[model samples]
Target: MRLLSMITLALAFSPFAISQDPTTQSKIADATQDVVPSETSTQPLDFWMQKKLDYSTAILRGLAFSDFDLIETNANQMRMLNKIEGFVRNRNPEYRGHVHAFERVTDEVIRQAKQENIDGVTLAYHQLTVSCVRCHQSLREAE
Candidate 1:
């Protein structure tokens, strides 16, 4: 009985148990591999932008398959990028607004991913893309 209880408890808390399905794990691995940069890359923008694009692609793939684990992994990556020093450093007021909007939308994506809400995640992802476009346009106009 004690052995049975221990096995049950271990299964409940194990990361492997949570994502134990081979198909799901494969999708997650494939999606992650699609975006991660080679070790030699050093530019912050290049790293973050690649990650952003990778995560966006992962999210779409996850949505197609109803793979919440893939969505959560990529959403967490986006949230991690929000903490990067370069991502937060902006002196221009308009650009700062765009940054804040991006952060907020990314947070929403993370939240929705955690909740496994496909519609919410999709909506937040769209908002994040719009924020990126708006920020880029502002930068071009400034230049």
Candidate 2:
């Protein structure tokens, strides 16, 4: 607890930790602004799971930024991301490969988005999103 508090305090006081690079910040901000809202639902798992895929794709496309920001960010997005990651990490390879692909494509998409290659980013994001939906659809069918 003491070590954790000291580390947190140190991070808070560090200039390098406090301020993000302007260009990277701007790209992330712009990407975050682009996520479309998910449809409302009473089913918690389905709602969050579907939205997680959407958010993941948006981040990949550079249309949606990380949930670390204040503006246009989903309140529960980080939780959803963690949940998806946990699910993916524990699942069998056949079920988890899509998550790995998502991580790769989203990383590429974000890079493209920062480079201002909008079309390329969009294509990658679209492919990743489609994969997520397909995977979930398969799960649903299996059940």
Candidate 3:
């Protein structure tokens, strides 16, 4: 219930507004501290996990196909999601720590992808996967 409430509040005041006009874009930076990509800013978290999963899968495909564009794009998207998620959550120290850790890994992945370093990107992806698992465990423990 609390998670649902938080989602509602985030969307209500967030860049998730239907149109990404100057006002909506401004509000996004106010809380999430980043420019949420206008294309995806409107989707609520209720259905956003699917997009996250899709992006993750695309990252893997990019690795397999040696597509730097795909990998960098998706990695950047994940970073944005991480920022929005941090604000939409309870904002305790522990939660913020998890967000920061994920953001670090996401940045690493983006950097490696841009450099076309498959080995580096693979290592960073492993770290990102582990971060996801740890954060999920923490969330369960909190509940």
Indicate whether candidate 1 or candidate 2 has the larger lDDT: 1
Q: Candidate 2: where are CA atoms >4 Å away?
A: 1-43, 53-84, 87-89
The RMSD of every model to the true structure, in order and in angstroms, is: 10.9, 8.8, 8.2
* Candidate achieving the largest lDDT: 3
Task: Give residue 34's lDDT in candidate 1 (0 to 100).
Answer: 43
Best by TM-score: 3
Candidate 1, residue 126: lDDT: 88
User: Taking the tens digit of each residue's C-alpha lDDT, what string does model 1 give over 1-143?
Assistant: 35334433543455843654776555544543443333334645466567777778988888889788777777755654443322334648887787678878888887897888989988988898898899889988999
Whole-structure CA lDDT of model 1:
0.67
Tell me the tens digit of each residue's lDDT in model 3 across 1-143: 56545554665575444456676355544634332322235765444456567768989999999998788777866777777667666457888998999899999998999899999999998999999899879888988
Clashing pairs in 2: 31-63, 31-64, 31-65, 32-65
Residue 59 alpha-carbon offset, candidate 1, angstroms = 1.4
Question: What is residue 12's positional error in candidate 1, in angstroms?
Answer: 26
